[model samples]
Target: MENLTLEMSKNTNTLQEQQLKLIEGNFTKSEALKIINNVVNVKINFHKLQRLSKIEGNVNDKCTYDNSRISELIDDQADMKSFLRSLEVNGKNIKISSTINITVEE
Candidate 1:
């Protein structure tokens, strides 16, 4: 019994981690916009799907949080476009760095 307990404790103590440098580069304004828009669009679509699923299941039609996030992303996209447009040269390069970390919860 004691040996089994020790083995279980050791297994529980193990930690798993994953990291990905998804984006790291300098790109022109148009390129940056495309990259950013692609990522943001996926996130927006995911939330929209979640909202639709909930509504279909009769879980909740409002999905207030998801709706709010969709609005925020749309607004952010507008802001980003404005910022990019303000850049003096279309050839100017912008640096973007994104890291994704995945871990198991204890």
Candidate 2:
């Protein structure tokens, strides 16, 4: 079992090394397979495609993790409103100090 796992890791690395050689752009499955085949001398099948999809997922996770703005926007509020005061103070109707954070940007 250990040997099998190790061999799979090795295969994954080899596939990844070839995957890195792809041109920067989208391509059909056949085109992608061709590119990898040109650089890799191993078997290719749906397994590689599935593994590459996992690699793409990891890359996407990294992209989202690196984006601080997206996390901050999650707790986003459309508008903030303070409690209204209509009573009098010091013999005259007065509106106390108030603040509203309508929008946040960092």
Candidate 3:
């Protein structure tokens, strides 16, 4: 169970790194939100699996610590998702206004 948690954390971290890359690029708002949603779902699934492992009495203190880490990850994911969604909406508005200005200038 500890191993599983560690693997999950690693995967989550990788996904976060990918999200950072996406932010660095010119990704659409919907694309960014999709990535964030994937991260949140992964974290939630990991948490559920960890809880089940604990209930089955197959997890140790290490697993408990990892579960705490997973909880933190989930919280971070939720915050990031909200922020990304806000950015997406704001960006779309800006783009629309810019396009309108260009059309007016033409």
lDDT of 1 by residue, 34-76 (tens): 8778878998899898877766866545545537899999899
* Regions more than 4 Å wrong, model 1: 1-15, 57-66
What's the residue-level lDDT of 43 in candidate 3? 68
Which prediction has more favorable TM-score, 2 or 3?
3
Q: lDDT-based ranking, best first? A: 1, 3, 2
**Top candidate, metric TM-score:** 1
Better of 1 and 2 by TM-score: 1
Worst 10 residues of 2 by lDDT: 1-10
| Clash numbers, per candidate | 0, 0, 0
TM-score of each: 0.72, 0.18, 0.42
Model 1 C-alpha lDDT versus the unseen true structure: 0.71
Winner by lDDT between candidate 3 and candidate 1 = 1
Candidate 2 at residue 98, lDDT? 17
TM-score, candidate 2, is 0.18
Better of 1 and 2 by lDDT: 1
TM-score-based ranking, best first? Answer: 1, 3, 2
